[model samples]
Target: MVEIIDVDAENVDKYGFFCMRSKPNSDGYQKKLNWVKERLKEGLKIKIIQENGRQKGFIEYIPGEFTWRAINAKEYMVIHCFWIVGKGQGRGFGSQLLNGCIDEAKQLGLSGVALVTSEQGWLPNKKFFERKGFKMVDKIDEFELMALSFNENSKPQFYDWNESAKEYKEGITVFKSDQCPYIQDAVRNIIEASKDLSISVQIVDMDSYDVAQKKSPTPFGVFTVIYNGEIITYHPETKNRFIKMINKKNLLTNS
Candidate 1:
């Protein structure tokens, strides 16, 4: 039987939300756990799918105002992460988890459910959300802001990137947070890459939703790598890829 477990302070320690079954004792896990703990009081909801005592998938969402993204989340629930791994993919688990969020939004009398999606990296592709009746509300760069609205008058919006991106003027600047378990490793990789390339990279650790919403270089929020005032990407990659991206950018800049 498939069971959905809501992660709370009571059972958070018992289950891994993102980096499931691996790196339990790692700093990333602890950081993300602590982040989750704090957000719970602000209305973050995380639901995990389990079958035969094994975790199969999970989804995390929060009130728009408290969402890490730069959006004006006044009357909606913004999904931070949604995933169903391994054998969980082709089954009905994804729908189950998504429907759970939709149902909760209705209960809370939220205007709708919203999320930022992309064709690449951390966020999910737009297809699934579109299939579930989410419409493309806005777009910033490659990220698509999608929402499923119950109220015809409610229109969700993406945070202002034009002003936010201007916050970092030059060099390699990384705006990051502990919201995801893997971000620690991603930051480490970026640091290592910076050192190898002899580049000075500034790390801006986003400790709260306010900081992220106000300072994120990209509208998608989470983790972003900015090179010379322009956002390279919103997701982290390997050291080699980072180097290549930087080198390519340098080439274009010098050309």
Candidate 2:
């Protein structure tokens, strides 16, 4: 039998946030764990799927006003992450979880549901959400802003990423938030790569939704790497990849 469980601050210790299950003791996991605790009070919701008795997949969503993404979705429910691992694919689990989110939006009288999709990184694809009735309202390079509106007149849109990028016009800046447990390692990798190049690095802590919505260099607001004010990456990569990306972009201190 399949089961869906709701995870809250009270039961989070029991159910976990789902991404860092294998490294609960790591800094990334601990950061995410604490972040989840604080976000729960701000109306974040997570649901996990279980097949028979084993955990298989999970989804996380939050009120648009408090979403970490660089989108204006004040009255919508913004989906942050969705994943189905291993044997969970090829089944109806994905649909089950998505429909539940939609249903909850209706129940709460939200304007609609919104999410950011991309062809790169760990985000869900636009095809799946498009098939489920989400419309592509905006586009920025490889990323797409999608929304399913309950009211036609009200919809969500992404912020001006180019304008936001102007704020970090010099040096290497790495922006990170506890929303994703994996970002801790990415930040570390960037620092290490910068060290190899003899370049100084500035790490920005996106500790609140306001900072993210206003200053995030990409649609994926949680993690970003800005090199001389241009966005080089919206997700994490290895130290070598960072080195190569910077070298290709510009001749820094050493490269």
lDDT of 2 by residue, 34-135 (tens): 999999999899999997778999889998999999999999999999998997887989899999999999999998999999989988888888889999
The lDDT for every candidate, in the order shown, is 0.86, 0.90
Q: What are the models' TM-scores?
A: 0.95, 0.95
C-alpha RMSD by candidate, in order: 1.4, 1.9
Per-residue lDDT for 21-55 in model 1, tens only?
58888888899889989999999999999899888
Error of 1 at 31 (Å): 0.6
Q: Residue 228 of model 2: what lDDT?
A: 81
Q: Point out the worst 10-residue segment of candidate 2 by lDDT.
A: 161-170
Assess candidate 1 and give its lDDT. 0.86
Top of the candidates by lDDT: 2
> With candidate 1 superimposed using the best TM-score fit, by how many Å does residue 83's alpha carbon deviate from the native?
0.6
